[model samples]
Every structure is written in C-alpha cells, then in structure tokens.
Target: EEATLLLRYGQWRLRGASPDPDELQILFELAAMGGNAQACLELGLLCAKIDRQGERIFMEHGLANFKKALHWLERAGEAGVAQGWHALARIYSRSIYSQRNLQVAQHYLEKAAQAGLVEAQCELAQVCWRHRRDDPLNDVKALYWWQQAAAQGEPTAQAALDAFAAQPDAQGWALQAQALLTDKLRNSSPFLSARIELAATFGLTKPEALLIDIKAADYGHCLVVDICAHHARSKRRLIAVQTEAQRATLNRVSRLFGDVDCGFDGLEGNYRQRQYRLRTTFPDLG
Candidate 1:
C-alpha cells in the first residue's frame, strides 16, 4: 500500500515535472509485486512501450518483457480493474504483436464493458456493428452500447448515435433515445435518467421488436413509462415499464444490454412530477 501510494504520488509529480525514471520504475515494480492493480497496469504499459532512451529494456528482455506485460495485465484484470481489460484488449488487437487475436481482444473488451468502461462499451459496439468476427451481426447490441456510452457523455458515442440516426434503416430510434436524455432529466436524477435513457434506446433499437407506444404507468410513485413493443418475427406484443426502480426493469434491459447489465438506480420522480402525456394505449406485460 505504501509503494502504491508512493507510485501515485510519483505519477502526480510526473504530470507537472520530470520524475526520475529509475525511481519510478522501482516504485512501480514494488507496487506491482504488492498487488496494486493500477501499478501493475502502468508497469505493463511501460514494458509494452518501445524504450527509446537506449535503455534496451525491450531489446534485452525481447518477448520476455511483452510476456511479463501480459502477466501483469492479467493480474490487474483478475483484480477487477477495467483499464487492465481494456489495455489487454488493445494489446491483443494490435497487428504488430505476435499475440494478436481479435477473438481474445473482443472477449477482454466485453469484460471491460461489463466492468463499466465507457470506451470498451463503445469499442464493443463498433465490433458488433462491423461484424468483425464470423459471428452473426448484432445491430441491436451495437446501438445498445452506443447508447450506453453516449448517455455517459462520450463524444464518439454521441457521434455514432447521430450517424445511426441519419441511417434510414436505423428507424430514428437514436433520436428518440437522445431526446429522452435531456439535461433536465439528468439534473433530476443522473443515475436514473441514464438507466431510463438506456432502456429507451434498447426498447427502440431491438432488431426483433418494433416500438409501438410509450405511456404513463398505471401505478407507481416512481416516474414510470410503459413501453409497448412488438416482436417483428413472432408478431408478439410485450410491454415493459421504464422506471428507475429495480422492480420489473431488468428482464427487458438485459435482453439487449446483456445479462450483466445491472446498474440500477432507485430514484423516481422526474416522470411522475413532470407530466408528459402521450396518445398510445397498449397491452401491459402479462
């Protein structure tokens, strides 16, 4: 813990002034060995980078350094650091590395996304959209993550959402999702608003379903909007209430965002207090 603290202090110093690389290296090594995930990640990155100062670190160690970097990265990931998974994904995706594997890369990216890394979510969405693997394309998933990142104020994700909105086949669901993510709603409850926005995006973007209507919930103190969606393939109608409460929210959101999607906020008043009327009546989820 001392070593990790020192390393963080050294890093903070590095932002303003030049710190001795030898000293920093020793601190990183100490902290990394002590199970500091951030230190391990930093050390891994240092090992992976080309040492231009004739230190001959990579040259002397050869692939040993790269392998060590992967070791530390895995350790960091095992410790539940999202950045570790993201870094590993990037390293595995790079063509210059002999260890390049898109499948492994995608796996780590998904792990990072599961850990709530916005960049990983955005990248995974792109991967889904591009159908980079032999696996079936999932535009719904692509839009889902895109909405996730966009709701978190990621500019790239916002641009992607805009692009999707421009596509005729996208059905303007992105626009609807964006509309629901207003600052007013965010101010009322950032956490709940984000979840509602996510649900809105998921409901509208489902490839198998067509959004039919959105109306006020029949009962609830929480701001709940009943979403009526019809499955295009099965011609089945389903209704999901978009609310901040954990009660009756997961099944629908997870259908698009994945089983790991569980970031729920219990704040609900924006919808209930500020009335927004609609002209749609649909069957409730039965």
Candidate 2:
C-alpha cells in the first residue's frame, strides 16, 4: 500500500501544472524499490530523457542517466513488460548513447517483437530489410515480422505485405527445375550439378547458370547473372537471395568454383563445352 501511494503521488505530480522533477524522481524510485513494475518502467523512461539542455547536459551527466535507465528498464522487462524491452532497444540503437550497440539493439528488438509488441514487430521488420545484404535469411525474417504486424491490423505492415505479394514468384521455375534434375544425374557431373542446383534455387536459366561467373555474380543480397559476354542472346538479370536454402546453395556453389577459372580457356571450357558435358552426362536431358 505504501508503494501504491508513492506511485500515485508520483503520477499526480506528473499531471500538475508545473511538476518538480526531483520530487517525482524520488517518489518513483521509492515505489520502484518496493517492487512496482510500472514504477520501474516510468523511472527508466524518465532517466533516459536529456531535457532541453541538449549535448552540454548530456556530456556532464547523460552516461550515468543512461546506465540507470538500462538497469530499471531491464528490471521492468524481467517483470514481463514488453515495452521495457522495446525502450531498451531504442536506447541501444541511438548514437547519443555511449553504450550504443546495434547487435544488442537487435536482440532486444527481437525479444520485444516476440513478446507481442506491435511497434517492435514493425520496426524489426524494417531493420531486417535494411540489413538483408548481410544475411539473406533477413529477407525471410522481414516477411515474417511484417506478417505478424499485419495480422494485428498495422496499416504500414499491411501495405508492405501487399507490396511483397506483388513481386514476381519464382516457385514455379524452381519446381520445374526440380522435376528435371535428379540426384543421380546431378551427382554425375559435380561441377554441372552445382550450377544446376544454384539455378534452381534462384530461378536462373540454363545459359545464365552454366556460363555466369559464380564469384562475380554474388552481390550478397542478390545474384547478378550476366552471361552476355559468353552467350550474346542472354541479358544480365538479378535474382534476390530470399530463402535460407538459396543462401546455402549459393555458398556451396561459390566455394566449389572458388579456385577454378570460369573463363573461355579454363578447365570447365567454354559455354558450349559445358552444355555438351551436361547433355552427355545426363542423356535424358535431350
């Protein structure tokens, strides 16, 4: 009951015409010490603010304030407040904080989203999309978070979902390629097999897969298949690496072709020779 009275007085002070920050801080701290989760959250938020003084005040006292904020927010999060985790994520992501850490921010953001915070879900989706080039699995993760937010009636997430749906689907091409390339035939020619698997994974055509340079084509987030130099009729195209399986296949194929020179006079020979080898290895491909 003492804790409740302290919290009430703190809230009352906040609602006053001109509240005393020192009094409110003391009241919230007393309540928070009495095991009040809401007090902890409120105290954390209060500590995180820099007031109107800006960088000068921050330089003098902001570090200690940030540390206190993290401590109280972590306590609130441990007490099952999803917004506490989200608040921590914000502080960790901002440059003003001396303890800024993107990796830690991502971890907390993910925790808040998983705990059913809609704002966290939306923000996490955007973060995943922005860093998709670092890890192709981020595309899949972004889609998942957007879907989660959209299900909760978030308009921006709904719009993003619609946009994702409008992009070209590559499942059909993947299925067709899967039907033609069997494990036995793929194993017959290790080099050709790797190319075929990679093509099927990213919806690449025969010419693009066989002639394109694996190392040169990989642009982290997407594959830039440009075989126009070897096959005049083929135009350069980009296929996004959206799935974990696609990333795995791409990594495997990249390692396979790492040492081998993929040129006209290389061990693999020209495009025609590679094509001939494929047909000879798999008689049914005719």
Candidate 3:
C-alpha cells in the first residue's frame, strides 16, 4: 500500500506544470524497490529516457542508465507485465542503444505477443514481413500475427490482410519448362535441372531461374527473383507461392543451393556463363 501511494504521488507530480525530475525519480525508485510492478515498469521507461539524454552528455552515463532500464524492465516482465517485454524489445531494436540486437528484440516482441499484447502482435507482424529475406518462414509468421492482431480489431493489421488477399495468384508457366526437362539433362546438370523445376513451380523467367540467389529469394509465401546485378536487362519481381507444389519445390531447390554460392564470383560463374550453360543444355529453348 505504501508503494502504491508513492507511485500515485509520482504520477500526480508528473501531471503538474513542471515536476522535479529528481524528486519523481526518487519516488519511483522507492515504489519500485518496494516491489510495485507498475512502479518498476514506469522507472524502467524513465531510465530509458534518461539513457537517451545521457547519450549526448556522457557515454558511460548512457550505458549505466541503459543497464538500469534493462534491469527494472526485466523485473516488471518477470512480474507478468506484458508491456515490459514490449518496452525491452523497442530498446533493443534501436541502434541508439549500445546493446542493440535485432534477434534479441525479436525474442522479446514474440514474448509480448504471446502474452496477448495487441500492439506487440502488430509490431511483430511488421518485423516478420520486413525481414522475410533473413528467414523464409517470416512471411508465414507475419500472416499468423497479422491475423491475430486483426482479430483484435487492429486497423493496420486488417489493411495488411486485405492487401495480401488482393495479390495476384501464381500463374501456370511451369508446364512448358517441365516438358523440356529430359532425364539426361537431370542427371548431368542436377543443379540446373533443380533450378528449372523451381522456375516451373514458381513461374520464374529463364534469367531469374539461372541467376537468382536461391537462398536469399525464398520468402516462404513468395519468391523474390532479383538477379539485376548479374542480368542487367532482368527486372526484380516476386512470384507468389500459392500452391503446395511450389512450397515443396522451393524447399528442395533451396537445400540444393544452401552450400553453393550463386554469385558471379562463385562456381556458378557469371550471368553469361549460366545463360550459356542453359542454352547448351536446352538448345531448343527460347
């Protein structure tokens, strides 16, 4: 009860025209040390603000403030405050923090989302979508979290879902490529054959199939065929992965290219070499 009163008094001071920062901090610290979870969270946020301000004054002071913020926020999170994890995630996501770490931020965001924080769900969905190139399953995770946030009446999440639903379905361009894959070609150039199969499955053009960085292009829900660096005439595009066959084929092809460098300096050689190899393998192809 004493901690709760102190917290209330600190909040009342904040409502004043100009409160004393030192006094407020002392009150918050007293409340937090008295085991008030909300006070801990508030103190953590206050310390984080101080840390940011300290950045312009003293590097050591900034680092110390950040450590204090992290400690109190962790305490709040352990006390089951969902927003504490969200706050920690926001801190870790910013480069201003000396301890900035995207992977750690993602972990805390996930924790907040699982704890039923709607804002965390929305933010996590955006993070997954934005960084899909780093993890192929991120798109799938994005969809899941967006769905969760939308169900909670988040307008932005609903808008994203609507946009996803409006995207064009994958076309049927694989049949022609499939007909060209002879057994001899499959045995002799297994890598090229796999690329052809992936192209057929995902509707990739000849150049995209030959020159795309396979590992970097697979975004689970879509294939980002960007080979513009190697093929100057080729444009970057996304092929939606709408079918089970496309997913399976992508998985297989990605595994094949996992250990192989698909860049110009790698064993695959430059765009011209790959194109020449493709033309040599399938002389009748357009």
Candidate achieving the largest lDDT: 3
Backbone clash pairs for candidate 2 read none
lDDT of 1 by residue, 1-286 (tens): 6867966965665345554555655777888887787887777766665321212233443343568777877888888888878878887887777979988988998998888889799989888978824542355567667777877899998787764441223435433544546677556544334444444443434322222222222122122222323233443222222234433444333343342222112122233321121111111211
TM-score to native of every candidate shown: 0.52, 0.55, 0.54
lDDT of 2 by residue, 1-286 (tens): 8888899989888778876666778998999999988888878877886321122222343344888888998998889888889888888888888889999999999999998989999999999989978984676678778878987999998887765441223534434545677777667667777876776677666777678899887866566677887789887555655567777888999999999888878888887898788667655552
What digit string (tens of lDDT, one per residue) describes model 3 on residues 141-174?
A: 8877887888799998888876554122242333
Which residue pairs show collisions in model 3? Answer: none
- Candidate 3 residues lying further than 4 Å off, grouped into runs, are 50-64, 165-286
Per-candidate Cα lDDT values, in order, are 0.55, 0.77, 0.78
* TM-score top scorer: 2
RMSD of 2: 8.2
Winner on lDDT between 1 and 2 is: 2
Model 2 TM-score, all chains together: 0.55
